[model samples]
Target: MEPALRRAYRRESEETRRADLIAATQELVAEGGPEAATVRAIAARAGVTAGLIRHYFHTKDELTRAAYLSLMDGMTAKGSDALEGVGAAPEERLAAFVSASLRPPVLDVGAVVLWAGYMHKVRTDPELKTVHEAAYLAYRDMLQSLIAALPRSASDAQLRAEAIACNGLIDGLWVEGSILSHAFAPGEIVTIGLRSVGAILGVDLIAHSAMLPDPGKILP
Candidate 1:
């Protein structure tokens, strides 16, 4: 075993272990809120000793904060990944992004539960609140970029305003669809989201979305 090879292996192993701990924390938090994700419970869930958590995170709060950020980052990645292979049309790309956000994985029950579980801490803990605000800004920035790409000319202020509005619309629909999923028909939230967002941006997202070779592929 060469020194370089050994170092690479050790780094990979450490990252894998850290990821496992974060996964365990997210699962416990989702299952029983933040209180269930104690360091002991996280270690047990990850099949590691409690002290092992200290090696990766300075404290339980740090670990919980990491899990929350992981959850939020994953959601943003899901939406961004939806843009892959999408055409240059701004409307199509925006529609795909919104649809991806409103559908499964991003709109899953467990994900929402995990987010809600951390709400209290995010509100009171200054560090966690900073993370929450940063995540929100990142998502909103992405929305603003997508909106800026549209055909119609808009000033920075207008783009920012539209992005905020669209973000709120999507967030509301996402929460309702996740918690009261049964209350709405399949694809209802997606349709509403596209229409509402399209109206805000002064484009027909549904019509543009339909232009795709297989609209159902993204919409579903």
Candidate 2:
């Protein structure tokens, strides 16, 4: 092969390898917790050699860190997509944002455990801490803006505080919804969460209670 052709072939091969590595990380993390997403497991899932993973990521932490960022990126993208064109009302938009942010491409227990493990790492890893903080801050700012757009029933400062509180409520509820057994279906957690937060924020959410689906009977 010509020199240029050989170079192009190598570039394509490198891209494919990188894609394989990332895909493997995503699969393992979505199917098992962080521990199950070891370099060995990722390599096996990718059908690549462990040496290849080592070639791309020198340490397990490095691989996990990359996977963590990827997971956040995916969630952010989906959440943003969910909020698009959903602004008929401040309340509606806020609900759209929260629902999008909580729901994910994968809803399995292993995926929730994987997220929790990465969240734990981000709480301590300085390099990853800022990324996690920024994501949360983005969500908080969005909710604050939505609340700010509401009627002037409260002062700006009061609204801001309420927004922050609302965000805290969302954070706690999202974790609960993600990990809790599927005894309750999607949106059930959201319903209970919205009611609780609405009471805290002095908002009237009871009217939406009728919109909530029944917590279906537990299956065998």
Candidate 3:
């Protein structure tokens, strides 16, 4: 696609313009992966020049890193929203976090497409790997906090192991829910994932069953 010149960017705040560029990158990546999200393509989508993108981000890698971070930040923030409710029981909050991971917005197809587009690069790209690791650690820390809030206290080492295992369960179920939505009934993935993770953490998620979702509500 050819780049379109837009004078409107001249009046836009730096932050706004930067966000536009990142959003453009996400759109392209979601539609056709990195090869299609080239600087030129991003510029076209954002209606900005390649030079302007360089001004905000020093290099292509820098911009891509920023975009990838943006993608992850939005996803994890929404995914962790169930933990944000005030005064909810720890068990319920835990269930919310699991449900968030397997529900809409958090389990969106476009977001999953963007994530898959970046997954291969994160392994070999140093900057991207750094971003991915930081996101991963932050999520694990969030899980640790949730686990620590439980009635039954756990040792630090045990909590760490449980966090890792629980995160694995969430991530794996996330893949299935996003790509293979037909395999399980609506909300079933959330139920199964929470049960599996509750087992790994020795936390009775089922006992907190009142907090879990009603299957009929999550229908596609």
What tens digits encode model 1's per-residue C-alpha lDDT throughout 75-194? 999989888888999999998889888989888888888898999787779999998998999899998999999999899999999999999999999999999999988788989999
Q: Which stretches of candidate 2 lie over 4 Å from their true place?
A: 1-20, 29-36, 49-60, 102-108, 153-160, 205-220
Per-candidate count of clashing residue pairs (backbone under 3 Å): 0, 0, 0
After superposition, the stretches of candidate 1 with alpha carbons farther than 4 Å from their true spots are: 1-12, 217-220
lDDT, candidate 3, at 47: 84
Give the worst 10-residue stretch by lDDT in candidate 1.
1-10
Error of 3 at 97 (Å): 1.3
What's the ranking of the predictions by lDDT, best on top?
A: 1, 3, 2
Which has the better lDDT: candidate 1, or candidate 2?
A: 1
Write out the backbone clash pairs for model 1: none
Best-to-worst TM-score order: 1, 3, 2
Each model's lDDT: 0.85, 0.62, 0.78
State, as a TM-score between 0 and 1, how close model 1 is to the true structure: 0.91
